[model samples]
Target: MATIRIGLDRLPPAARAAVEAHTGPLLTVEETAEGFNSEIAARVTSATGTWHIKGLRADHPRAWTQRREAAIAPFLTGLGPALRWREEVAGWDLLGFDVLNGRHADYAPGSADLPEVASLLCRLGETPCPSIELRHAEQRLEHYVVRPDLRFFAGPHLLHTDLNNANVLVGDHAAEGDRARLVDWAWATRGAAWLDAGYWVIWLIAAGHTPVSAERWAAEIPSWHTAPAEGITAFAAANANVWSEISTADPDPWTLRLADAASAWYAHRRTG
Candidate 1:
C-alpha cells in the first residue's frame, strides 16, 4: 500500500530543525513522486549540499523500513546512493541520502537502458551479503510457495527483491562500470542470487516484454544460469499468487498490471 505523502515543510519544527543541522539552511525542497514506500520523499538543498530525504513517523507501522535502509546503506557503496545522515526526533525517523543525478530506468523493449540495468544487476550479483539482520526470501514466499520448493529460494547472496524500474537510476556515463544505481533498499533480502533476476522478469513483462523475452534478458545475468528450470517455474507461480493478493487488497493499476504479468509468466512456465 502507498503511504500518504507530505511535504518537507509539513514536518514538525523540531524535526525540520534537526534536518537543517545536517544540511545548513534549506534553500529549496522538491517533492518526488516516484516511490510509494516513504511518506516523506523529497530533494532538499542547503548552502552545504543537496540530499534526498525520506522519513516516516516514528510510530508508523513501516518505520522499521527506515532502519533497514540505514543498516544496509553502507554495504551498497557503488550499487546504491550513499546514506549521509539519520535523525530520530520529534516523533519521526528520517534518513538523508546523497542525491543521484539520474533518470529512472527505461524497461521497454529496445531501450538503451536495458543493457545498463543488466550491468547493474551483474555487479549486484557479485556483492557478498552483509552479516546484518535481513529478511529471508524463502520465508517471505513461504505462504505462497510449497514447502518443498522453499529450498530453491534459499541462498547466501544479498538480494534486492523489488525490481520496479523506477527504483533503478541510470546515470549519464554509459561506458563507466557502475553507471546505474538502485534506490529504495527497504525490501532488501537474503536469498538465492538468481531470484533477483526472476523478480526482474516480472517487471520486464509489466513493461511490455513477453515472458519468453524477459527470460532471455534474465539470461544476461550470469547467476540466472544457477537457477534450475523447476525452481524458476515455482518462483513464477509464487509471484503470481503474491501479486494476486496484492492486487486484491489494493487494485491499483500498477498492481493489477503486475498481477496480470505474473499470471502470464506463470502460465508460460507451467505450460512449457
Candidate 2:
C-alpha cells in the first residue's frame, strides 16, 4: 500500500496547539519521505530548536508501532536516534526525535560508511535488549521456514531487524566518532546477535553488492563471524520468504526487486 502523508496543518487543532506550545511557533515544517508506519513525519523548526515529529492516528493499524519505538529509545546507545518526547495529540499519537546532523548513509558497494555501520551493529549486539514483549526472530518467520529451530534465533541481544540504508545516517565529517546512526526502531526485536546482520545482508545485495561481497561485508562484525551456519541458512530462507510474500501482495517494482535479491542470497547460502 502507498504511504499516506499528513502535513502539519492536518493535525487536530488541539494537537497543533500542544506542539506549538513547546516548539515556540513553528518556523518551517518539511515532510520527510521515509518509513511506512507514520502518517505524519516532518522536520519542524521552531524559534528554539528543530525536531522530527512522527505521528499516526491512534486508531491506525500501526499505531502501536510508535509506542514500541518510544519504549526502545532509551535503551539504544548508538543504535538509534534519541526520542526527545512522546505525546498523544488529540486522537493521534506523536513522537519527537532529536534531529541529528547527517545524511542517509549510502549503501552502495564499497561506500565508506559501511565500516561504521558494521561497528555500530557490533555495539547494538552488545546492548542488552530491555524486557519488552518483543517478537522473537524464530517466531517472526515461523510459517516460512520448514521445521524452524527455536534455538537458532532466540537470544537476549537487541536486534534492529530493519537496516535499510535510509534508516542509517552518516554522521557529519566534523562530528566526533563518525559513527553511523541507526533510526526507525519500529521493527526492533530481541534475537540472536547475528540476526540483524542477516537483515543487512539482504539490503547490501539490494544496494548493489554481489553475494560474495555482501557476505564479506557482513563478516566484519564479530557476532556475524560466529553465527551458526544452520541459523544463518534458516534466517536467509525466512527473509527470502517474507520478501516473496510482500512482492506477491504488492507486486511493486521495489518489492519485487528486493524479493529477487533475497532469493539470490538464499540460493548462495544453500549452493555455496
Q: Taking the tens digit of each residue's C-alpha lDDT, what string does model 2 give over 86-187?
A: 889699888989987788888898688888888888778778889986877777777888865666888888888888888988886544444688888888
Winner by TM-score: 1
Tens-digit lDDT track of model 1 for 67-178: 9999999999789999999999999999999999899999999888898889899999999999999999999999998899999999999999999999999999656656
lDDT of every predicted structure (CA atoms): 0.95, 0.85
Error of 2 at 16 (Å): 0.5
- The CA-based lDDT of model 2 is what? 0.85
Model 1 residue pairs with clashes: none
- lDDT score of residue 115 within candidate 1: 87
Local error of candidate 2 at residue 93 (angstroms): 0.3
Off by over 4 Å in 1: 174-177
Indicate the worst ten consecutive residues by lDDT in candidate 2: 171-180
